[model samples]
Target: MTPAPGGFTDETFAAFLKGRDEPSWLADRRRSAFGRFKATPLPTLRDEEWRRTDLRALKLDQFAPPAPAEPSEAARAALEPAYRGLDSLYGTGIALVDGHAARSPDPSKLGGAVFVDLASAVQEHGELLKDLLMTEAFRDDADAFAALHAACWTGGALLYVPKGVKVETPLFHLVGLSAEGGADLSHTLVVLEEGAEATLVQETIGLDRGKAPGLHVGGVELILRRGSRLRFVNIQNWDTSTWHLSRERAVVGPDAALQWTVGGLGSRLAKVNQEVALVGRGARAQVNGVMFPTGRQNLTYITRQDHVAPNTTSDLLYKGGLKDRSRLVWRGMIKVEPDAQHTDAYQKNDNLVLDADARADSIPGLEIEANEVRCTHGATAGPVDPEMVFYARSRGVDEATATRLIVEGFFANVYDRISVEPVREALALAVAQKLELGSAPTLASAEAAGV
Candidate 1:
């Protein structure tokens, strides 16, 4: 069997599994996932979850799983431009090029935490990953992209904190792609045991302009044990040529809390599913998102907050801005089970359309089986209030500066919820840079904006 050049065929999968000298347990898991991947069909317009997205533009056959990651000086330098001020802000960090680790986590700052690439974790800490790897966050009958990610995922990380450990300093990860038409399948697993606490921040860098048609199928699993705490932030900043598809899920335990934030600033098209399950009493979760799409880009994010136990609370907010002919879609749901009494849940999504041709869709829903639960959801999408722009412009701010100020204030709602100063500042800076919204307070001629 040999690998395919244009697609992931049976021969390619078989050859891939054979080349890796993995233990039987991991090999068997991959094989099982491969079977599932073969059975599940690719997403299409007919699928309700994918109905709003433009499926016709995605040419899945054009991307092929990339070869194993190898060291490259150019790759390292290419990644440096993104995620500025990372070294001083994070206690430990990992830089990956095409899924392979270019820099591993620092030993000194781990503070007895186990931070290693998934492959190494499989070899050195097999006991820790035995039953907790993919079982907690994913199921056997997952979507095609998720199943394929489980089968072909190559370079990712696993962070495991022992009971009673507290890693006060934030950890960092950078994911980058260097080759055009290449596919990267990376998986992240984070586990915090009883009474443990940690924070993780992840960012992605895609192939530069003139680089086109890349693919990313990724997965993330966060498992929190009793009385634990975790704060996670992920910023997807791939170039406009990349098609990003990912499935992320987290399970919260008794008395635990999880704060998850996301920033969607790049990618030609991105569809993501993020879910958090509160399965234990007194569990809590907060989700925040900031998304901006421009230049014909399309971005979609779906989130679910499931409360399965009594006395659980969840709050979610997602804000997006669109320009050019770009489009943004956000759907959120909060579900409370019959036994989840005293559950409190809320979700809201808002979008600002900066161009007449640009479009935005926001949908919020609730499914509650508990009589005692309180759940509320709301969604709003419209162009920037001419009144707000006018107000800002009245205050010595030119039109460009006024619009920029309005956009920043709109997104600041979520930024204020981020608690971590560095993460908040970095995200704000990146958004300003990507949108070219940072400049002197000139008149910002409509002609300059291609009006």
Candidate 2:
């Protein structure tokens, strides 16, 4: 068996297996992933996907899996407020502290749903784990962080939705990354069988008092079977001193549909890759994202819409706001295969720059192998329209308030993509909070300053 690499050490893998009571098959898979991990080197700026981000300062060998976290009374009290509205949106809620499950989730309401940690799933659903882990669900060659996640993942959250079952509340999975030179490889897989419908929410937060920088490699997979529909929402709020790397992909089967909405807020440096495939006819997909950056943080987004079947449709829209010296880069592609005769795909990326030093880049392209297909792609990177800013200021708004209004208006389109009111409102609130703390000044904070 191959050993884990980059400070994980063979001993660490063995210890992790023994501690978790992992089955033999699961252990063997982890062992082989280490080999695959060693075969693939860490990604550099030379890599096409990572061309815009700098990695020379990052040393993967410097970090290690953290010891379990034990939150204080105050910490627990702080988390209590975030848990109240979950029941309205999810059937079962799983909370992960550091890299382990902190509380047992009651899956009784979810008849066909299986919600558990990666460690537990390996033991209970060995065959499933062997079949799905690191497969086409996650395309590792696109980025090295994905391969590293496949190899060093110590714990994760896995959600399985059985056929024909509709979940009322979205599944809420909270992953907390504590400091202490700690590293977390958290993975989430959501499978919706034929004719099923569900909504899932994955919330990531980083909290650590240590001065040492941490790392988070997250992978989430969503599979929509024939005639199924899935609405996915991602909320990323990492610590300012952490490095966040994530890849989210979805496979849409015949007559199936997928709607994805995302918000990127807190991170010293973050890279998110979102990919969707129209593998069968009559498949529909909509991808939307909103990002807010401040200080010297950097945000990079890469998206792909792959069409393999006729009559497939996909639309993508992403908006970002950069402030201070923060920067953002967006690269997106739409690929139509020869067999895809009547595919309809659209891609758009828009940026709202709030300051002179802030920067944003957009790369949008389309590859078509079929002449009958209709495809359009465009990208725009510019500051807020001066006329709009002036109009807002003439209505009694200050410069900061005018900029905030423009940025908020820029993201209005993404918010309109969601069909659910409560969910949309929740996401709007989260986006607003991030922008207030990030680029725009908050009303409460501004009033306090005025006082």
Candidate 3:
């Protein structure tokens, strides 16, 4: 059937699938997902989950599906600085420009792991891809945007770690969009087998502020098998003209552990939903996030920690700084099922307002069906402490400098909680850049100097 006028049609989706020459199963999956997307109406402000975030200004019909394009000199030049000194921080790196694989990782460094483009991996690892892609952690019908993602996702990343293997160095995947009025639909699927351990860093960047608006719909699904461990970091730095929406979920098996970190510093408007499910006994998950929203940006984040089995534990902490007329909304929830008797879950969201016009909404919730579970949540949003600024000013710091120091210290807790040094340092630098504190002393450096 043809798509509605000005909206993406089933025929267009079918043509996209055919152009990719994807596997039959994937084509079928796309068709199914497309049908779901068609059936599911666009989310409106009336929806509970979307009531706080407004999307009426967005014109989805203006954006077309992204196609592979050679990275312009300007795009390449802009991306180079982000990777300037990151070479030593990652053992393998993959770069995607405008939803195409621009640089691939070295096969030798991958060892037994599978690190390849999603389209290529679909052909190489058909059975495994079929079992996990768009089916396990993230469902197609989860939301209208999710179904649209499953149907139109283009170049993406797939990382699979075999059992008993431990990747010492981190793997980095960079996805960038540079076109105007284009849609960047990408998916990232990471599977860690039993007893495996690995760290992955994924960064999304919009290199161009196109004349017309752009759209980015992305999905990430992470699976941790029994006794496995994973540390995943996501950094989003889209340009101010793009509308970003994404869903990320993880499932942890028995005795598994997950450490997830998120950094949100860009995008004109973004709504992200992230969740982690502890599905087996002795599973543990820790989530830490840092966000800095400036200009007129509006960023919304929703997170869930689910305990489905006994003896599972989960902890989450998110910190954000809002400046200019920027606004942020954070909703965090912790759920304990009836069978999760020994569950322990905690969630907190803290926001620092850096300007009078800046606004923040922090909401923390808990759902407990297990009487024996220990579940707690808290949220706070306020300007930087005047007492702290006063104290810093007394020490010869200017007001802006003092506020910057206070803001840095506000986010230092989450950064300290993260285990990877490189990731922490990179995030700190990014945050400093966002705060316009290029030459200012960072919390880490200040602490090192006994300040």
TM-scores for the candidates: 0.93, 0.89, 0.93
lDDT of 2 by residue, 337-369 (tens): 999889999999888887899999899989899
Q: Candidate 3 versus the native: TM-score?
A: 0.93
Q: Report the Cα RMSD per candidate.
A: 4.7, 4.3, 3.9
The global Cα lDDT (0 to 1) of model 3 is 0.82
lDDT of 3 at 119: 72
Give the better candidate number (1 or 3) by lDDT: 3
Candidate 1 colliding pairs = none
Q: Count the clashes in each prediction.
A: 0, 4, 1
Between the candidate structures 2 and 3, which one is better when assessed by TM-score?
A: 3
Off by over 4 Å in 3: 1-5, 68-85, 437-451
**Candidate 1 lDDT trough over 10 residues, lowest sum:** 438-447
Q: Show the lowest summed lDDT stretch of 10 residues, model 2.
A: 439-448
Which digits, one per residue and each the tens of the lDDT, describe model 1 over residues 1-451? 0124758778778777776767888888888888888899888889989988876877767765556536367766666644334655677777777767777888889888998888788888887788898989865456888888888888888999999999978998778887532777888999999999999988776744355567889899999999999999888877777889999999999999999999888888999999999999999999999888888889999899999999999999998888888889998889999999999999999998889999998888889898997898899988889998888888888988888888888898899999766777766766665467421110111112222
Number of the top lDDT candidate: 3
Query: lDDT per residue, candidate 3, 174-262, as tens digits?
Result: 87777532678889999999999998888887765565466889999999999999999888877788899999999999999999999
lDDT of 1: 0.81
In candidate 3, residue 393 scores what lDDT? 90
